[model samples]
Target: MHELAIMESALDLALGQARQGGAGRVRVIRLRIGTLSGVVPEALQFAFEALAPGTLAEGAQLAIEQVPACFWCAACAREFTSADLIAQCPDCRELSGDLRTGRELELTSLEID
Candidate 1:
């Protein structure tokens, strides 16, 4: 799956950071993945397990933070969370195209030593 490539890239970044920080190993890797990011957490974990060997992240803990999708409704002048591609304002019952979040897929932090 594409998660393998994604994990590879994440490990590369983590390694680079660890090197820059003079760390010999990575302890933890934290990621912020939104509901709409389309990346599976299980797949990512499997990918990490497969690719972490012989690397600084060999035994690093992978922490995934799930973010819910949020959208803004102009008619109601408010923001709300949703799990659907087409967000509908709960109160206003209006379809909102103004998405404010839930498309994130990024490495947020790392613990290394």
Candidate 2:
């Protein structure tokens, strides 16, 4: 699964940050995941379990903040959320505009000792 690779890279980044902060161990990792990020939470969690055992984040808990896919409709002059990949503006039915948020895979923070 690509989640394995994603989590591996994220864990490596966390480990680097932890080490930079002089952390002996990591307790938690806070992630901001968006609907459009194409990541499955269960799979990512499973990947974390498999990859964390031999690192500073061995016993860390992964805290995920799920963000909805949101978009701004210029035609309608409004913002909306959609579970669909192709979102039509509710009012104007336009399929174009600046995507306000979502599409995120950000590692927000890490709790360490």
Q: Point to the candidate with the largest lDDT.
A: 1
| Top candidate by TM-score | 1
Which parts of model 2 are misplaced by more than 4 Å? Answer: none
TM-score of 2: 0.92
Tens digits of lDDT, candidate 1, 1-113? 88999999988998899999999899999999999989999999999999999998898999999999999999888999999989889998999978899999999999998
lDDT tens readout by residue for model 2, 1-94: 9899999999999999999999999999999899889999899999999999989999899998899989888777788998877789888888
Using all chains and alpha carbons, the TM-scores for the candidates as numbered come to 0.97, 0.92
Clashing pairs in 2: none
Question: CA lDDT of 57 in candidate 1?
Answer: 89
